[model samples]
Target: MTSDTEEQEDELLALHSIFGSDEFVRDESKSAGELRVCVELPAAFMVALTEGETLSQYEISFLPPLLLTFELPEDYPSSSPPSFTLTCSWLTHTQLSALSAQLTDLYQATGGAVVLFSWAQFLKEDALRFLDIDTLLELPSGEHSTQNCSQDSLDVALSEAKNNKHTPATGPTDIQSLDLSALSLEAEQTLQTSEIKADYQDDQSKQISKEDFLNEGSVLLPSSSSGPLDESEQGAASLPRESPPNEDQRLSGRSLTPSQALLSQILIYDAAQQQKQFATTVFDCGVCFMGLLGMDCVQLLCGHIFCRTCLSQFCKLQITEGNVQGVTCPDADCDAAPTPAQVRSLVGEELFSRYDRLLLQKTLDCMPDVVYCPRHSCGSAVIWDKSSTAAMCTVCAFAFCVTCKKTYHGTEACQKKKKKIMTENDAEQPTAAVPRSQEGMKALWDDYVSGSKQRKRLLESIYGRRSLQNGLVECLSEEWVATNSENCPYCYSSIQKDGGCNVMRCYWCKRLFCWSCFAKLPSQGYLDHFDNGTCNHFGSDFFPAT
Candidate 1:
């Protein structure tokens, strides 16, 4: 749409502007080109930089200046906005920050020209702001824009941008060597910047880095210096704080290796051997976000992860409550089959002890595929130990004296004692009814197999309905939260954000108050001073908003 002459003219004009502009200086490099600019910041604002700790949100980059041609209006007003593009230099968190604020300032300045800001050193003598030095030759592990090599990446990038100023490699140096002339000059410049910040701040108390001001662990709580600020107590005078979770989860390959395979073999081991690390690896249950105490956590049929306590609790509680159809992944989201094999391996024989053989047979036969044991050591695992009058532990093979209900614990009379105990067991076991019980189990199996889909669909339907219910959503509300505060309006009381929104009960007075203003007495709840402007107490009829 445009003519070639217009483009060429624009390009040449931009070049002229760069060469003639006093505010920016251009550096030439074999690999790249760069433009440089620097600005001094007030200390208070610098401190606020730290408070903006959402790593993803803002970047304080220490990057090289950009290099691009900008076409200027012949009648450029000193107050008119300036335009430029960012390029060159790797992104150091600090540099991008300087550039952003500076660019914004320049564009907003009266007749966008060089705002001659001066530092004591730079104004008296034109000085370079950076040095070609590499500190700490560690790998760049955080999310980087480029997958560049680690050795002197930033400084080297700068050097390359300035046209490949190669300083021959001197093997990695000690900290002492870091203060040498080339590096020290930059360090000195850095020191000057720090001093400038401190000088401007004068008030250390008011100048804490924004990041420091925010205690990552201090949930919406009052500052420590302020006093007995419990995270719970909320008031009108205090501001509510909302922050994001720490992204500490790292990226690591989890392929099953030879070592892991070897470990798997030893998992079912109960034989007499030297004590080894019982729990060497921990896998969070794929289903539930519970802390699996041991390394043996696994996903059964549904691949939901759970700790022994959580998984066992869910399975027992649900099944007992007559939700056998729903005795699956305790995780509200998962509906996978609970693999019985995985459960047995973790618990060994503990799961079997939950019921006598009769109840177990019925349950297992009914939910053959939907069995799970909440043992960290045997997550999504199963153990195989067949028992007659006497049977060897499939894992340990230590010949348990089942008659005596012991293993390797039998003496010469152990076999005799086992024989006598099992003799009673044999009688107690339904020998005559074995055929009938087995037939009944067969019939039960047939019936279930015939209606498997229907049963499963019905169970899933009920579960989905319950979870999506309004009450469940209300129970998981996340908005009604406040931090701890030192000063309470109602006497000497401290508090933390327990739950709910916009309303809080003073533990001491049992009276509620406006979560925002503790100064105002609560006119609501159990002691509703409705006459005094508070609301009524908590009631089942009360349904929280979605």
Candidate 2:
């Protein structure tokens, strides 16, 4: 026959083989070990919390494991059962106690046999159903685990005190009587003196009544209160009361219950488990058409999976080519895009920065009330004011008009510089002869350039690409003339200075003016006008002395 030690060793070896090292650990010195049992949850198991009329529910796929620490005696399965302790975070003390008692009963029913595996199986597969937590588990509100722990400690202390036969039992009333009987006359006298001093220090509204003093004195020394204490007590009968909790405090008092706080931990564990499972699972990449573990794959918003290498290269190509809109899922039918964090992870910092800039520009371009600062080097986004014609770039501090895109001229009309190709034709026609419809179309084109993406699309749909190109050409031509030439102050005609003196003559109006000051000058004595304090004869920017 095999000895008890041999039987115990054989049982432990069998458990180790069944559970593997991850779930079971054995001590070589003695018949002892620990087992971690993860309770299997049903597919639709839900956890719910209710506050007033609002009910919130969540489905959890994972929970923290229950720990079972056990130590076996020399008698082992031949006589006594294995001594074990089962512990879990989500279960109450009463529930754990019930499960512990059931485990002991299972041992007794086994009639002297190894029951460790049976206990483990019961905890893993049947604990929830046995506890009658079938589909939904309702968590308690307004109850803290600390309060329960403190209460349990108090109960244990009371039980120990009760079991001590040497000490006499004392109720609260009896204890108070004993204390009163033990007090001396000197302590009473000192207490009365302290009360008198407190009366003087406190506010007048809080003054103590003679009855209150005498009544307290009577409680201490009953012999002194036989005379007029009854009449004084009747005269001042008000008592202090507790202040009520305010509305805000009352509402926020239950903001985080014990169960709700624990639910956050539970959800976190569930997420970690899900991620671990995903990392180990194999997935087929949609783009590369290769089988790979989830750790090497990227999952897009549309639930399509692709190898990280393929997705990273795709994003890099799009960002490098300045096609930010095309940096989305490669699925032809889907338009799902990667999140900014995912983009950052897939691509390095330099490429991500480009992607971020292009994305921001595209987003800003779609807004009707947003425009870019016209400075080529400092092209920062500026919020356009619809009511005002001028906008100030917060970045570079350049104040320019929204209409003419030139320096802001408050309450002044925009300087509309016609294209060089149109100047000759425009000069042949009268000012009033220019079509109002054409003027309106020009205004519309200006608006379309700075308007929202929807407005641009609508305009394009109505006028077609040819009209847009013509408007763009006109805008570019005007912008070029505005940058390269100055207006001839008299006729308001654009004039380029190709190495000349300060005195200028308008080609259309024949009016000579000081180019530096735009001041009209006498045709014969134009040189004298350059001697003014603001103008120089040699076309230098430096002004002459007055």
Candidate 3:
């Protein structure tokens, strides 16, 4: 014959194999265990707050599970049933008492057989249906001390059913399923402090209301027009009257309602479960097009997934090419960039450092009040001063004028350019000023014109506003003439070629020249220049039509 201990061991082993660690826990030494029974929700059921004037409903796919804790006695299943408690946050005290009675009745119907699994199945699959809650579950307000009442009823009902053999016990009123007495000393102290704070808040709110009422009603009466009131009238008037609490005060001191508290628990549980499912599932990488488990891939902030190897290679290429901006989502339609931490994980510290440096440089280039130190060896960033054109490099201790990019010379015209502080050998060499590239000049001009009023004024203070205006006009004129005409080789004056073949006459000098080569052509045989292969009479090299 099978012993009661053997039957208990076999059932526990089967349960451990069926449920994951998240749902079931067993205490082998005490012959006790706990199971979290997650009731199945229907397709479109809603949960709502019961006391609100406006209906506040939420569509949820899952709720926090009901905790069922049980302990088996020495007697076999043929003699006695397991002692247990069913606890949930969303159910009312009345509902909990009814369910506790039904569970006892279920054990009686089982005829001394093991009824643990049967009760769990009933809670998971048919609890809501049995309670006649088809579409919605309404939660009570904070005014209901439902958990205390439910605890008492549970104790009475279980004690009567077992004939005082054993009584069921409940846990606290949160998502956790541990006895309140088992809480740590620190947690108990925290609870006490929170209660004291709540009481203080209530007292402060009442005092503020009383003071406001007295200020509004205590107006001085003129002795000539009105006689003094009796002592009873003054005493009655001094007593505080009831009124609605201030909106800000009410919100700051108000505790969450029971329905709100339960709703928050349900939402938190649903999100956690969804994340756990996502982590273990398989997904297709968007970049490499490889099917891989989520543990081997990376999910970006934009919700795109790619294998780590592919993302590493992509980021490495971007950093190598100095195209730091391209280190973003590989999806053509999405422009979301990976976070610095994610990028660091993929490309490693070395490449991520390079990416960080280049990104910072690009950002500083866009700011009007930032510039780089002129020393070639130490190209550190320097913050520009609004009051003066001179800036000092914090890294190299080099002070230079911002406008001319040379050593600072206070109130003096800028000198001829010298070689940038490169090697110590080249630092003192006198070098011609390098002309700015077309792109560099355009970027600088854009920064000056499209900058804020303060930035524009700062630039104007350093370089006179009239000088800057003339420089702009000169830049525009040079661009226009360079596009429309050629310059005279001798006088350096612009000469437009309107008509005639390859032969041109400068209006300023009356000198004949080959329009194609701009070579000084002889007045007698100016057409001879085109006869040679060096120049073309009607080739695409002629000035573009206006």
Residue 335 lDDT (model 1): 72
Ranking by TM-score: 2, 3, 1
lDDT of 2 by residue, 1-546 (tens): 457778799899999899967578776556777687889999987877676788867787777667676767777777767766554556654556556656766777888788899999999998988788888877655432210111123344445445544322421101000000101112221100000000010111111222232222211110111111122443311111111111111112343334454454455455555566767889998887999998898777678888999999999998766678899999888899987777888898988886786677667877888876666445467898899988999999999887776788999999887865644334222112111364354444544554456445545544544456564556546766888888887789998666567777788898888777788788786676656465678755533533
Superposition error at 484 for model 3 (Å): 50
Global lDDT of each model? 0.32, 0.60, 0.60
Residue 151, candidate 1: C-alpha displacement in angstroms: 29
Estimate TM-scores for all models: 0.20, 0.56, 0.47
For candidate 3, write residues 253-341 as lDDT tens digits: 56544345445444445544445556698999998788998778877778898998898899899876677889999889999988887
Report clashes for each candidate as comma-separated counts: 58, 0, 0
- Candidate 2, residue 14: Cα displacement in angstroms equals 2.6
Ranking by lDDT: 2, 3, 1
Best by TM-score: 2
For model 1, how does the per-residue alpha-carbon lDDT over 309-355 read when each residue is reduced to its tens digit? 66666666644333445556666676775655544443346432332
